[model samples]
Target: MKPMKLMKEIASDIVSLVYPHICVGCGSVMPFGGGILCAECRADFDEPVLDRCPVCGRIIYHRGKCRSCNGTRLYFDRGHSVFEYKDNVRNAVLNCKYRNMKHIGRYFGEIMADYAEKNALCGFDMVTAVPLHKNRMRQRGYNQSDIPAAMVASRLNTPCVSALERVVDTKPQNFLSREERLKNIKRAFAVRDKEAIKGKSILLIDDIYTTGATVNECAKVLKKNGASRVEFLTFSCRAED
Candidate 1:
């Protein structure tokens, strides 16, 4: 090994011994070196049931498309998510988005990559993220979506493209009811490069999938600009029913 690299590894080990990297979920030190969650937390991380709507991937009791997507329609053909947005998964997302635990983002990204590889995200020509508005971007320092997109893109061996822009600073979806969320995000996003996304399959990445308002709007815009297909993968989603 290069002396410099070996020295760096040694230095990291020494620092780790003094201040170990702890799992955010349970506050126990991580036993392995790959991700933020400890082995037990990773094992405990529950996968959502496959009872989601085919179009939105939110849990549905006895149907394919949820009521919203069934009648209203969406540009994105389908959506998939790794875990339900509750308990440890919810806390992990909050930490990743607001608490600067970027490692958690990478961990969730790996889960998404594994899921995509095993169950096929159809034909994603490129990966992009649902953009945060400019002001939000400045406030947050980084887009949470980028971490997952980067990991999945690297694993899938496809290009990661930042092809969409949130032109308007919309309110947090958590603050709004479902009706307001739909209104707040409508027309807030715009395509940045028509040539890049035109006739290409796009996989949109985000931290959470709630009402499907944001992703649906994003998919609509992408399709309008000639994206061949739009699909999405989120870390957490609520029960569709």
Candidate 2:
């Protein structure tokens, strides 16, 4: 190893010892060389659980599918999420999306990358993000989903394709009821460049999966424009059942 790089690593270790990194969920001083979180918190995080809905991959217990997906049409071939969006997961997403905490995005992206590696997510030919309308993009200054999408695409060794465009200025899905959400995003996305998606399997990346309305609608547009298959990776999902 280069001496300069080795020195930097040693210095970083010394700094961590003096001021231990804090855990995002608990605010406790993370143990030395313990990686992202302390053992206790790591144990508490119930990841890699198999109890998920077959279609959307949200956590399902006893119920066949989450109520949000029941009787609803989905356009994607499959969907997967890293964690259930509750408590710490919810706040972490809000912080990254609305509070400009981009490090949170990178952290969640690492989790998604791990899941992708374990679950053989390298089959997709291209990757894309859920598009934000021009108006909303201007208001937010950045697309929250793009950050994690970039990270995951980089990890998956695929080009992140910006193939979909949000031509319609739809109402915010969070502010609307279930019926209104479907109405708001219907026909909201369009595939601008056909050549990029034609005959390719595309992975759509997003920060959160809620009613499956938004991602499914985007997938429908991509498939209509000749995408062979559409799949998704999301950071979090709510218990809609």
Name the best candidate (by lDDT): 1
List residue ranges in candidate 2 displaced over 4 A. 1-50
- Per-candidate TM-scores read 0.85, 0.81
Task: Report RMSD (Å) for each prediction in the order shown.
Answer: 5.6, 7.1
lDDT at residue 8 of model 1 (Cα atoms) = 53
Which digits, one per residue and each the tens of the lDDT, describe model 1 over residues 1-241? 8777577567645644433367766667655554566676667685436587777787778855677777776788888887788777777888778765655666788888998888877467999988988898766656888988988988888899999999989888898987899899999999998998889999999989988899999999999999999999998888765
Give the local distance difference test score of model 1: 0.81
Provide the overall lDDT of each model, using Cα atoms, as 2-decimal numbers: 0.81, 0.79
Report clashes for each candidate as comma-separated counts: 1, 0
Can you give the lDDT of residue 177 in candidate 2?
A: 80
Weakest 10 consecutive residues of candidate 2 by summed lDDT? 15-24
